[model samples]
Target: MKALFIPGNSPYPIFSHAPLATAVRNAGHQVLMGGIEWVLPNIASVGLPPVKISPVSMEEVGAFMGAMPEDPLDQLKAVGRVYAEIALDSLERLLDLADHWRPDLVVGGGMFYTAPLLAHQLSIPSVRLEWDRIDARMYDPGAESVLAPLLAELGLDRVPEPDLWLDVCPPSLRPADPVPARTMRWIPGNPQRPLEPWMYTKGDRPRVYITAGTRLFSGDALRDMARSIAGLGVEVVVGAPENVAAELRDQLPDVRIGWVPLDVLAPTCDVIMHHGGGGTDMTALNAGVPQLVAHPEYPTEATRRITEFGAALLVDSGGQEAVTEACRKLLDDSSYRERARSLAREFTELPPPAEIVADLEQLVAARA
Candidate 1:
């Protein structure tokens, strides 16, 4: 079997999709990753007028998006427009790949909405992976009005045949309400690292892991976040390029810091400061390190569950005092560690992602 994947712009998909990709290859299916460059032609599906805000400039993008009603219905209109933009910009290239790869199935993460169309065009079954359950009404406030209709239009109205859906989410993270009579399988890979290997120590200096920097990161706010950690006698590890690091370094010379791999450094740190992307959340939690998330616009279901599971602290991109205080609370109190550990216990108990991918292959085959 030959399998192809459609990826998105964010870094999270690379990690989330890795286990499944490897599993497919190991099981004798050739896997090819279709980078988002193919998504260009389909960008039209996301109408530009509704997607008034631009991805190029993050500062202007948020304020512009904010002006639109925060209601889910309005958000839906905006997201639809944005998705269409992505489709118009990338779809042609997506279909063209089929001519060569001749994949048996096209699997996609929902972030790139055009995958369904690509599957239809090529006359192949499309498998969509969801990190979290999709419940229209259960979203943060104004979600249902917009999300429900979109899913329906996408053919989610019917239970996918032979349980084609692979939802890695466990019962604890899933909403109270579920799609009735739909048999969903849990294929888990979001793995965990034991704390025995990674212990948290305050030492004479505090160690803080800042995941996302101001590339519209609330630049001053993130700088303030660094400052707050420094003031508290803590060391900061900011993961950014040389220029940004150089700039920030000029501002704070003495606080211990460097740009290192998340896998290596996150385990050594006491707490992680990030913008709540899924990979970072999973990595930090699995390492038994608590989180401080600066909530961003339009966080997906995965982001919502991370906070609900008590693995992280939600801090708005506001004043430094507030950001500093949240960091203090997480570092000073032991309760945050307990919550992260609790979630980690559950995250690890399920079957790893490799097994899940193999199960998905079986499911797809059964249907065929």
Candidate 2:
């Protein structure tokens, strides 16, 4: 079978969809990925096969982000508008690509509007790989006005729903939202990199992994958090780019620093601290490590869910004292670790991505 995977024009979505593409390929299906040019490198970095879609300029995305309203619901609406605009911009090119490729099925990340649009045009089944809790605000009635022109152009009165929704969040961690979904095991898609010797070595003290993801690096705050945590008589490992690591080394001479893959470093950690990205949060859960998330911006659903599950703590104030206190609780409390392990077990017991290949095939056959 030929499968086309469409990731949104963002690094997060591209990385998130990589594992599913790999699973499909491993199941003896041909998989091809589509996204804007900017995110194609990230897809290729993970060694996934990709076919470039119509490019959306960075300036356009940047302007949309910059112009987003302060209210969270408003922000989601703004994002929906941007996605609709990008989808409209790329519609013709995407149609042409689909005509040439003639894929049996279409798969896309949850926020990627183009995949469903293209699939609707081709009259083929499409699946949305859930990235986080489905925000109803993103699908607000107001978005109809913002998207009406494009929807009219495509002969669609509204955005068509995907045939399937693939969710990776464990049942206990999922929100009470009513979206019917098929649960897939959370597989960390952090890019594969060389492992450092220290990653495998057990330290004398509890190990803590600290990261702020590739984007949204908190410069001084992260250094301060690392410094405070280092003084707690624990081993501090900072995952960052080489230049950032060098800068952090100046602030934390005793801390280990480098770009170690989260999949390798997470298992060694007793506690993980990060900026509350969905990918990082899921990685910590998969590793059975308790988390301390400091998100001054909108806290992701994963952050909230993990906290609700008692496996993690959220620090929204963005203060050093809050971060320090949360780290202390994560280190000193045994309940957090126990809950984390329980969540990890739940994730482990779910059917692996490869196991879902037959289900996807059935869905496609039914569509045919």
Candidate 3:
């Protein structure tokens, strides 16, 4: 069978889709990926399967970003609008690919609005692969207000729901509002690279892993947060790009700095600190490591659920003092570690991606 995987025009969504695509391919199905050009390099970097780039340009993405309003609600609406626009822009290429490839199934990233529409047009079954629980809101009440015009252009009345929704988030970390979802074991799909010898070695002091994610980039606030964490008398390792690491190096002369995949780094650390990205949160959960999330703007559902589960602490401002205090709690408290291990046990009990492949095959066959 041929499966078309549509990833969002961002690294996170692409990363989320990789392991599942691997599973499908291993089950003797052909997998074809689709997305914008900017994310293609990152997808290749992570060693995802070959992709067919959409006609959407970087300039279009830039314009979408620039047009975002200051209000959070407005920002969300704008994002929805852009998602629709990208879907519209790529409609022709995607349709052409579908005609040639004749895929039996479509697995789409939650935010890649084009996938479901195309699948509906072709009368093929589609499924959703979500990065986190926030995807539950994709079809919420006001979604039509943002998506209707685009759907209308395609002669679609509404964004058709996928035949299945793949839930990677652990039950303990899922959102309150329930949706039609099937739980799939969470697999850490961060890009792999050569690991340094020191990464495996235990240090004299407690170790802490800090990252603001790739999108946070660099700023005085982030640098100060790193500096303060480095000063906390613990062994500090900062995961960032070379340029960001260089900037942090000026402030933190003795801290370890480099781009190490979270899957490799999480097991070695006592506490994990990050920007509350779903990938980072799930990685920490899988590693059975406690977390300190410094998410000022968008505190994800995973952040809230993890904190409520007693495995993580949230720091809203990304302030030095707040993060330091949270890190201290994570290291000094035994309950945090205990809860994290419990969560990890729950995660392990879910069916692995390889096992889920059979289920997906059955679903496709039934639909076909």
Which candidate tops lDDT?
A: 2
- The digit string of per-residue lDDT tens for model 1 on 33-135 reads 6544322222222211111111323444455456665664666566555544554455556656666667677666654455555666566677766533443
Q: Which stretches in model 1 have alpha-carbon errors above 4 Å?
A: 38-79, 131-163, 178-206, 213-218, 256-258, 298-309
- Write down the lDDT that model 2 would get: 0.78
Give the candidates in order of lDDT, highest first. Answer: 2, 3, 1
RMSD of each: 7.8, 2.5, 2.5
Q: Return the number of clashes found in candidate 2.
A: 0
**Candidate 3 Cα outliers beyond 4 Å, as residue runs:** 46-48, 57-68, 136-146, 153-156, 213-217
Better of 1 and 2 by lDDT: 2
Cα lDDT tens digits, model 3, 193-285, are 887877877678889988856334255666776677767788888888787777677777787887888887788899998876677878888
Assess candidate 2 and give its TM-score to the true structure. 0.91
* Candidate lDDT values, in order: 0.57, 0.78, 0.77
lDDT of 2 by residue, 72-155 (tens): 667667777666677777778777876677888889877677788888888888998876443433544545676688778878
Instruction: Give Cα distance to truth, residue 145, candidate 3, Å.
Output: 4.4
Give the Å shift of residue 49 in candidate 1.
35
